[model samples]
Target: VEHKVLAGPFARAFPDAEFYATDRQYSFPLNLPDSFLGLPPWTRPLPESGAASDGSWGGEFDHEVLTVKPGPGSMYQDAAFFHGPSGTLLICDALFAATEEPPPILTEEPEYLRALLFHARDTPQEIVEDTPEARRRGWRRIVLLFNFFFPTSAAVADLGVGPLLNLRPYELGWGGWMPFRWKSREAEEEAFNKYSAGGSPTMLPIIQIILSRGGSGEDTLRWVEKVKRWSFKRIVPAHLDAPLAMGPEEFAETFAFIKKGRNEVRFCDQDVAFLRAAEEGPLSFSVYKSSLGVLRGQPCGP
Candidate 1:
């Protein structure tokens, strides 16, 4: 995770600050243990219970734990805190949002620029001029690919099957690699438009897949209801554009696709074709209801 550079400094600077994490974070079932992932020795695990309220910070924060029914590819959970004074709902990754502007952090680096231009080109044979607009084009593609994993606008180009003349030159540093190709500029723009959705917040596309399958969505819905009870006017997720000027109603709307009788998906079906394929194949994430009517993700078999 390469978190030591940032996490080590922070942990040292404010050694007394309360540190909280879920138990699974330390003993992650699918990923590396916390010791290697960068958790300091002083860290403490948050309560395993779904909801844990702390009257600390002058009783201004309402901390709630949210968990999805675990599946083979499961292990999704987050702690949301409702700040009473600011009326802000703070979260880690339950929801996500990204503006069109290229994040300033990656703008000046040479490697980032090269990566951006990689997505800007139609194919290896075509040369794209390095420019501000070209860099912006690369960032847009990156955002789509990062969120959807393999948004509909791009597809892998099979170098093994293509003729030598069509292949890119070795001097380009990608002569033998299986690079992806864009379906069309229009397709890329269309997929991005759906993702932006007029700058509205949306849940992870994976959650949409679970709910679409056997997942009843009851567990997540209940968590949403719990969060809505707090008096928050703005929601701030850990990633992307923060402090969204939205209220409880707007925040609740993000999970609309998961509700029963809903036919629509969290994101466009075509846009998330790659995620869908991976879920059914290598990912194989699924959910079901238990005998007690509790919905959980189906665990992966050994």
Candidate 2:
């Protein structure tokens, strides 16, 4: 969410490349910016995927477009979906998978990192796991979601978090499957008051809510149906070490967190700061949790 806001750098970085997005949320000051390749808006009311455009990649790539228009109060208003050859679906910042791979970043001591991972210890058992053969047995063709599960170690490369660095104090809370206690109320309220009222949208809450609570169940169901209809099999996140072998059964487990009751999801600004802090930056995880405890409207220990 920080930095990379400028289209100037991107304009220089890929001068020869043609950029196509649903809409340019970030762009040059000029009314007619030439850096990007333009595409039409998805104003039509069609649920099914359709022929997007002639293969810009010269018949080597066939593109199908799917659109996600999140409900009110959502950070993501409009998202464009792309399906490439071999059933690969491309998306950004919308869905994420929580894989078993170790965090790219660590907390100095491996032991301490282990302690942090203790929180992910209780991941649900019901999400189905199948062998490659089993995954391929019944389905001849399957849709694969790229970056379906975000914040993956590989996806965030060259960004704020990526390439398997040490896990920061805050990133430890990535998977909401773990039960965490907030440190205190005053700390949390102070943060919300400071950041929310006077500033632009921060990455903390956007990442936190999706990882912990899945944002909205209604939206999840809608997307899940789309995935199912498309028969997506693998999840190829931008930051994963490699594409995860997935199917309907796999998507079921990967996205289950989003179905959680909204009442149960909680975000701690203190933790967000910690997670986003510079490497080895100081922040008390205990205190951060306490701060979240306060945000949840729960009593904290004195």
Q: Which candidate is the best by TM-score?
A: 1
lDDT of 1 by residue, 1-302 (tens): 44223564677688889776666652223366676767788877776333444545677777777666546444556778888898998987777776666666566787766777776766665567888877767777887777776665444444455535465564334662434577766666666666767667876665565544444366767777888888888888877677788887887887776654453543556556666566556655343422222122211111
* Model 1: residue 26 alpha-carbon error in angstroms: 7.9
| CA RMSD per model (angstroms) | 6.8, 16.2
TM-score of candidate 1 to 2 decimals: 0.74
lDDT (Cα, 0-100) at 166 in candidate 2: 31
Instruction: List model 2 lDDT by residue over 47-162, tens digit each.
Output: 23334454455554333333332222222322324344566544444434332233344335655354434332223121223333222211111111121112111111133333
lDDT of each: 0.63, 0.34
Cα displacement (angstroms), candidate 2, residue 231, comes to 3.9
Clash count, one per candidate: 4, 29
